[model samples]
Target: MPANLTADFLKARNEFRAAKDRHDKLVALEKMLATIPKHKGTDHMQADIKRRIAKLKEETQGKSSHRKGPQLDHIEREGAGQVVLLGPPNSGKSSLLAALTNAHPEVAEYPYSTVLPLPGMMRFEDVPIQLVDLPPMSAEYSESWLYSLVRHADLCLLTLDGSLQAEELANTVEEIILLLEEHHIRLVRRKEITEEEMRVRDVPCRIVLTRGDLGDLASRVEELSDLFPVIVTSPIDRTGLDALREGVFVALDVIRVYTKLPGKPADMVEPYVLPVGSTALDAVRMVHRDFVDRLKYIRVWGSGRFDGQQVPSTHLLADRDIIEIHLS
Candidate 1:
């Protein structure tokens, strides 16, 4: 492994990380495979990339083979957000998902056990963040779906083996990042920088160690904390679960808003609340984008600083505020 070749490998990896779309990832993966020098040092990387390409091809074919499901229709729900869980086999992901939400994914003690993605709605302070438990990444499993999910995820909870050694942990994280990069998903390594400095590059990741009560796992947890937000807990101990839930909400970057109308106060028709970044016009646009253009006046009440204020349709709304729109 020449130093330059190693550098090229890293560069190609980053190119894959920053890729925007599926086509981009495929192109970057091909380039990454081409850039790595065909030597003993890169032999493993080359093989892994070839495997990834083949998997991607299979997925592309699979998509055409199956009819699209109704879930494809985009409908924003009250406080709805999406977070995906990524970890090695038997890292307590199924347990964590069961602990956090109503989702009853099959919990077992084996590798590649979760064959499909399980989505569950989790409530956190008037907001609902959808948590998905994905299949484990292993030598025997395809990493393609995991990569795709991580790229689209608002946040990622990287699970660690509570019984693994420090060197083993490092190696696992390195490989996870490599898969993420190979799929062109951007991630910021928590090591080598400060949290405030971390904001410069927007990579959403948190390190969570399951079964942390094991003696001396603190140091292992500490080691992972250097590169990402680290949370340690055992299912039995139940520590850090609240922090973990809050972290998911923070990652979604949403705020809640309530609805209000005089006589129809209790007539909540649909999506009763919305996320913070949502605009007054967003509501109208959501109903129909044409409403956004025709929106004339908005009467807002409750929950916001400016209660009972009549503002323009473009007025930015705050959490718990009630809004009544009047369109042209």
Candidate 2:
């Protein structure tokens, strides 16, 4: 299929090639992406443009542009899911990351302490969730790669200073929203984006207030609840960290199902994870697509009406459920 390239896109591509500075290059690339037609023929071109835009933004916004920020910025998702941290500078992202995971991202009082995407595994119960501390977002500095990262992420945690007054908190949120909107990113409180959101790139996100011990955060928390689901935390006391971990797991919207041979015990240690509300057939498909053809019926153990009861393939599986399949 022909790309059916537009004249505006051609001009923008030329401008992008001629642009010298990182910021200007990013602008031109975005223009090119916007002008390009969205279709199968242009998918590869769109991806290439996005990749270049991400690399340029990483080099320009991050303080460690001298390093390999461009290549190192794209982190593959691991563990149960990937959750990216979004916030302006001095929002205690590094401190929270250090406290939650073994990864130590430079924790400092100054702004722009973290200049790269730091990945760490955070344990919730027995499951691990990958949490990435990304470069700070502000009106003046924002990595273009950040939007794509969040769009691909299972969840997003927007951290803000809990000590800020009501006005400051509002202003900070406005700044974060404005910057993300500028990149055509929107944050919704839903775990799954609707079909209408595909065009806008709406992402599921929750607000996290760090340093809650700094001031009277109770009132602020109560006020913010009407707007967004908020979680308060303090790195010093480990307060709300557990809740935050659980919250992240919940945001992932996944269920763990253990499978067993007809006569053996279920593999409880490493349960197969699937999206919530997945049916027994869906679970079978995860274990092996071929099972879909051989599967007759699965016997449910946990979370079933009766222990060791047989359930239909369409039966919905809940978290921590165990299944024993009997093939004909």
Write down the RMSD of all candidates, one decimal each: 10.9, 10.0
lDDT of 2 at 150: 72
Pick out the ten consecutive residues of candidate 2 with the lowest summed lDDT: 191-200
Q: Once model 1 is optimally superposed onto the true structure by TM-score, how far is the C-alpha of residue 197 displaced, in angstroms?
A: 20
Q: Using alpha carbons, what is the TM-score of model 2? A: 0.77
- lDDT for model 1, on a 0 to 1 scale? 0.66
> RMSD in angstroms, candidate 1?
10.9
Cα lDDT of model 1 by residue, 144-228, tens digit: 5456566656678888777888778877877877766665555653212222221222347887788766755877877777777
lDDT of each: 0.66, 0.81
| Candidate with maximal TM-score | 2
Residue pairs with backbone atoms closer than 3 Å in model 2 (clashes) = none
Best by the lDDT measure: 2
* Residue 47, candidate 2: alpha-carbon lDDT: 81
- lDDT tens digits, residue span 217-294, model 2: 888787677656899999998889999999988888888888888778778887777778778887887787788888
CA shift at 236, candidate 2, in angstroms? 1.2
